[model samples]
Target: MLIVAIILSLIFGSLGFIVTINNAKYLLSGYNTMSEADRAKMDIAGYLRFFKRFHIFLSVTLLAGVLLLYLFNHNWASSYMVLYPLLAYAYLLAKGNTFYRGTSGQKSGTYIGIAILLVVIIAVGSGMFTSLKNSEIVVTESQLEIRGAYGIKIPKADLTNVSVVKQLPAISIKTNGFAAGDYAKGSFRTTEGRKVKLFVNKEAPPFLLLNTREDEIYYSSDEVSSNDLYKKIKKWQKE
Candidate 1:
């Protein structure tokens, strides 16, 4: 995740340098699409200068914010990684309107940009809210159910082993799922090359490991004691 943040920061930061006045006609989005008369009405040079400075500042701030959040082990670090860039772009579009002269086309473009930004903000916010919730584990008569994002149900017939371990296997990559701060919920590949479903807090200990015929699941939550949950699952399995 840290690597992903760093790479994104670098990519966005470099964009300002990439779109120069000479290449603005071919590279910049709105500017490239503008009619010659419409382009003439705008202060392209001034906007480019503003653009360069704004993106540089955005990149630096994003990198710094993520680093600080990660160092403190704040769960918000994950949210910051996504939301900061989006909010920055929103600011960019809002402030960018000032550089456009009274061009009707530019006004329409600005409206479209604002509309898209709002939609993206709402979507990302909704997903973050869902992923941040703690996963719930429920035991049924014939199967075990894990509830919340990336949830799944496992039949009792598939259970092969159930135990509690002090530590988790080292995760190599998140194949499909969410990982923020110490909280991780999703599919991950271990350093040993085993794929597992994890709903565990990395900083918390005594994770419940359930080995099934098809997959290994590691689970932990602040809402329940892992040791107690392990015992319950073990007892339930026998019945």
Candidate 2:
């Protein structure tokens, strides 16, 4: 997952720089909105230089963060990696309005609003990611416990069926939760018209199906071997 994230960051970051270099006019659409005298006084070249430097800084910081994750897997470093770029980009956006549009700092309320919105978004997004990433399932003799966001604990006595399957049926509806790429960690409805809870990392193979008195749950883990998990659960159920 870290490798995939790093590769995607490198690809997108490089593409942003390429587009900025090749298509400056596309981003400076507001140039025409300026007064004639303001437009004449605009240092178009200087604006482009500022953007180039900003892009480079952003790209390098991301790459560095990726490398740090690859090497150490530090949580603080990971958070810093995400936080710093957003803060830097926010600063750039505020500064750009003044530099490119001749807007005074006091008049850049839109920029300030956007920066605040971005900060809120980053905080919420980071919190969600952390919650999902920390999700885990624990099977005990009396109960199966799911830990993390959208979690629940089911008593073994209430479960009617517990088994492992090679694949899951199609999902009909996501009653709640988030699904991105290969990660599906939340509540969903199966194609068979059953409500299911999912805490899965990869959707493809090796899943556990739990049928309780009221609901069916589907889950898998990236950190543990599926066969080992199945054996553990079966043993716990017998106890």
Candidate 3:
């Protein structure tokens, strides 16, 4: 049930993004006086373009974020997943439809008012209510094992090792830009030699504390990153 809910939430989020994106374009076209078909295409193409640029990161983060939510609590992920679509919907409304404004030189989408109204209704109807619930995150001193996707752990020993290695990060530095993304850039790999980007570390080794990519990265075609692996570290220090 939980898995199914996660997948469905993803689908809903994707579709919701599409709907709101198109709606925005349509509305903007109305304000800008774009043709019906041109407006429709812009409505979609804009989101598509934006998604393509960030899709690489968004898909990984959202999926991992939701799945990891399962570790904290059963519906924790599901509850947040529900907001994905709502968020996308609200984005278009907020981004506005057109660049042109009224004669007063105040440029705003003519239909934004309507979109905001709908967002308010849909956001509430879609279960936007979440009782502020406080929960503690249990982690180990050496390594905390999260019982979810990769079930990764951050061992105190490894953190110490990384710290120790940090004194001589040159050992972890590679010659080329293979580690280009820096701390900000995280990665996941697949059995088929395919690689995906990620933000969370789910593949750190106990003794490998510094944020160096595993001598050999953790690979899996499925949807998983080592959860605790940090490929992020100082460059020249490693150099």
Candidate 4:
């Protein structure tokens, strides 16, 4: 997650240079689409300067905020990554109205854009908050159920093996799932090119490894003892 944050910061920082006066007509979004008459009324140079400053500030502040959050709680850092930029962009759009002198249609588009951003922020923030909660584990006579985001139920018959391990294979990337801070849940590709399901905290040790006919599962939680869970599953397997 930190790595991802760093990459994003660098990318945002670079945007200041990517869109310059020479390429504003081709690369700038709203300005590029405007008719010459409309464009003539706007302050393109001032807007560009504002754009550069916004991105640079966002880049530096995002990195600094993430670093601070990382020291306290990784989950918060992850949330910050998503929240900061979105809120910042929304602020940018609101402040940008002063630099734009387009028609009512264009002004309406900016308002619509801000509204959409707010909706997205709320949706994503809520989802992340839910996912950060500890996943529930329910063992029934017929199956082991994992309840929460990216959860699954493994039938007892298909469960081939269950054991505790200290380390996980190198994860290549998330194919389909949620990963934030030390929390990772869902499908991920291993360095060996194998797909696996994970519901574990990377910073936590001693994960329960469950092998089924269709998938390999790695499970852990900051709220649960993995060794105890492993023992329980082993006893359940024998029955």
Q: By lDDT, who's the top model here?
A: 4
TM-score of each: 0.90, 0.57, 0.32, 0.94
Question: Of the candidates numbered 2 and 3, which has the greater TM-score value?
Answer: 2
Residue 63 error for model 4, in Å? 1.1
Q: Pick the candidate with the highest TM-score.
A: 4
Question: What TM-score does candidate 1 reach?
Answer: 0.90
Candidate 4, residues 1-239: lDDT per residue as tens digits? 67888999999999987999889989988778888898887788999999999999999999999999999999999999999999999998888878977678778888999999999999999999988877778899999999999999999999999889999989989999998878889999999999999998888888889999999999888788999998889999899
**How many residue pairs clash in each candidate at the backbone level?**
0, 0, 25, 0
Model 1 regions more than 4 Å off: none
lDDT of 1 by residue, 1-239 (tens): 68877898898889989999999999998888888988898789999999999988888888889988888855788889888889888888888788889657668778789889989988988888787767899898999999998999999999899999998999889999988767789899999999999987777678999999989999988778999998898889778
Report how far residue 127 has shifted in candidate 2, in Å.
2.8
Error of 3 at 160 (Å): 64
Candidate 3 structure quality by residue, lDDT tens digits, 113-193 = 556767675654443232212111124443433332223444434432223121112223222211210121234443455
Least lDDT summed over 10 consecutive residues: which range in candidate 4? 100-109
Error (Å) of candidate 2 at residue 221 is: 1.1
lDDT at position 139, candidate 4: 99
Native-referenced Cα lDDT, model 2: 0.68
lDDT of 2 by residue, 1-239 (tens): 46544674675466456644345545454554556666655566676677667776677777777667546644444455546666766676666665545546433654666668697868866775665464588877678898887889999898788788888769888889765545576789888887778877663459878788888777787677667777888788788
**lDDT for residue 17 in candidate 3, whole number 0-100:** 51
The true-structure Cα RMSD of candidate 4 reads 1.5
